[model samples]
Target: MTAFRIALLATTVLPVLAVAQQMDPSMQMPGMGAGSTTEVAPPRTSAPAQAGMNGDHDMGAMRGTTSSLPRRVGAKRAAPSPAGPLASHNAGTMDGMGGIEAQREMPNPPPPPAALSGPAHAADLVYNPSDMATAREELRAEQGDLRAYRVLIDRLETQFQEGGNGYKWDAQAWYGSDINKLWLKSEGNGTYRGRVEEGDLQVLWSRAISPYFDLQAGGRVNFGPGPQRTDAVIALQALMPYSYNVEASLFLSNKGELRSRLEAEYDLLITQRLILQPRVELNLSAQNIRELGVGAGLSTVEAGLRLRYEFIPEFAPYVGIEYERKVGNTAGYARASGEDVGSFKYLVGLRSWF
Candidate 1:
């Protein structure tokens, strides 16, 4: 009976030991059997693991002492910030930071003057005084001196009338500058009967009053068969509009007689060298001066139309027809003197000027 009990206990204990040997050591519990030990691994650090995952771990921090404060996952240490007060301001905001602010502090250049701003403003350009003086001197040197004397024989022609052939002449000469002139004028006519019908001579001071007009003040002497008279004369001579030459004169005789004359002439160019000239002359009187064959009101009117071919600019030969008539008391005087009150004539004349 003792041997049987011992054998049963040995068999059970051997089977238990074999099962314990097959179990894993980590899975084994403490106090499970004799010679078994319990072990606790050091707590794992999650920071280094998280740092490695985020790829932002600082090498220096990794080598330095571990920190008790938990490190932020995926957070980066910021770069060293700029050092001044302005540095903290955003580059895009208007806190007076950055290149834009620097530009604002700079002084700008002034704009150009209006006169120098464009091509159209060139008229306002200024010239240096020295340069202007030099230009004026050069111009004066180029011009030289002006002429002091001039002579013109305006009419040295003869006219023949049908009833009583007659000859006529007019001439003038001047001395001095364009603005003022000393003038000598002469005009006369002779009848076919060997008698000097009318003659006049004048000395005038002429002044330019306008571009196309001259004012003449002078003394006139009339000499002929009937009577001789001296008169003071004031005259206006002009190159009128439409290229008409006009002369108007008022005479105050020494005896207080007043007389006036108006004459106008125009040349029509049929060709460059061929011209037709029409002329009219009117004489008026304020009182009868029967001694001079002059009467009051309209005394005489003469009209002529002449056609000439100018062989040269200074000379032209003309053939013309002229009509003369006496009016008012002048016509009565003509009849009292047994002279014709009206007359018509064919004329051939030379018109020459110098």
Candidate 2:
């Protein structure tokens, strides 16, 4: 019975001691109390007591650090933020505050040319060098420098006239790559039963000066029944606005004579396979050539309207009406020669290109 009473008394006394420690500061264990080595904050003042003090009493300066306070917890201070470019948005700018990362912000200069790093042909390493060279050359040729040729029989037509029957031809063949070509152009008119009246052949070096035009410089040789001569020629051939094909040529004859010719033609599609083409050619001479029945100023002008059915784009047969006029002094020369100054003829022709 004495042992049970002693256990009960011990439990009651322990609770009483804990309550006393919490209610009274002086009752706490020695090191944990207000007078211990660790500093203690000043006792807090009641609201009325704080109001009676001077407003500028500088309470924070007098109070000790709250590190000793009860019912409070402590945390580690945040690490100082990095101070360079990645620190803030303004760190990479040019305004005196920015670092190296800000000064040259353009994309890293294009990775040093990938082209020049290896052998001229990497295949050369694994294949027979000679065969590789040959294949590489073929690739370049097919890509850019390949040679090609085309023959365009732009005009091959026979004419029926009150005076007589005649044929006319204007054709060109060119051989080259896209930027440079050698051109052969020929044109002539003659009666069916007689000799060629006027004809010329041109050997030109043509260079593409624009996407739509070529500038050609070459030599021309006149042939047929007329006075034979050689001329230096410079010409422009262009596909102009609205799909108009234009050719203008200036010629300086061996005899110091100058002449020019301009031709323009346009195709109007009536149907995918049927087309109407209206074309004009003007010939002008700087001076008269009595031997050739030519005169100064405008020599001749011809205009034609043709309707063609293109069975295939590479070949088209056309039938057309043409009006030809001899102008200025050339008209007088034609009259003197017992020829008509103006005439209209109907013709059929085939246009082909390859």
Candidate 3:
């Protein structure tokens, strides 16, 4: 029992003495007090989470150093976030746009014009006083043009008694008295002649095919001492101021007479109302006819001048003078030799149309 006690006391004293000797170094440091020294050991390295629990405060500070602070919670402030790439696009949306109305300085345009705008819009215009006169002048010019077009169309479609667009169709009746008639006076050396016979009445029908041509197919029935006669004719009438007419006809008499005749006329239009026409007629017998004044065969030529005044486009009254002559072998023997007839005839007639 005495040995065991001594061993225990020795063991306890030795450990206490070692601990006191180790702590003596702390007293020699600047901040350490005698017998009050408490040594603080350098902090141990640890994981980020373990550093907080371990009493190693330097580990937390080390994590927030300059290079690592941007990742840390409350160290250096974060760099400002960059603006989006599209933020500057709106500045150019209207940046280059210019103003409206850039054409005030153009050059040279004509003036003193007719209607500046159409009739449909004219009433809606608000003209300044300065422009009123010009507008009125232009309106007049436009109206004139309209009138001219209207007249042109009217002329093309309408017809007059004289001529209608070169087309004509009409029926005409004529009755006239010859004041003097030719009678065979002599059948002389080489030619036969005729004397003034008694007056006679002539009747016929006339028509026009166009302004430039005319046709007459009618009978001239003579009511006098001479045998009654009938004649059919076709004539071409020109429309120029100096008018010319040529005709061919078939002549027939009451005594079964058949012959052909050709006639021509020329007229001068001295005025719109007055016309002078000179007419010539020739006759030839088809078969031998010993009866009447036309012996065996007959050939007659007649000429006349007619002066007329047209009261209207369709109607005119004419007065004229005429002369006639006859020729044939039988005519020379039947009448006195070398006898010819010439006379001044007066005529009054109506020329009309529908």
Give the winner by TM-score: 2
Q: Report the C-alpha lDDT of model 1 over 1-354, residue by residue, as the tens digit.
A: 999899999999878655644443335355454344433222356877756653433332342333333333223334444553335445676565656777988889777596456754243347665676777667655563233765555554456666668877777788866678888888887877788788999999999899899999999999887678899999998998889999999999999999999999998999999999899999999999887678899999999898888899778888888889999889988899998998887777777766
lDDT of 3 by residue, 45-152 (tens): 457745456352323243233221113121233342265333343443444432222244455688645755454445435666447767767876676322211001
Native-to-model Cα distance after best TM-score fit, residue 244 in candidate 3, in Å: 2.6
TM-score for all predictions? 0.59, 0.64, 0.33
User: How would the candidate models be sorted by lDDT, starting from the highest?
Assistant: 2, 1, 3
Weakest 10 consecutive residues of candidate 2 by summed lDDT: 67-76
Worst 10 residues of 3 by lDDT: 149-158
Residue pairs with backbone overlap in model 2? none
Q: Write the per-residue lDDT of candidate 2 for residues 40-99, one digit (tens) a residue.
A: 234566889768865643332342322113321122223435553234333345466554
Most lDDT-accurate candidate: 2
Better of 1 and 3 by lDDT: 1
By how many angstroms RMSD does model 2 differ from the true structure? 15.9
Q: lDDT of each structure? A: 0.76, 0.84, 0.47
How far in Å is the alpha carbon of 203 misplaced in model 1? 0.9
lDDT of model 1, residue 282: 98
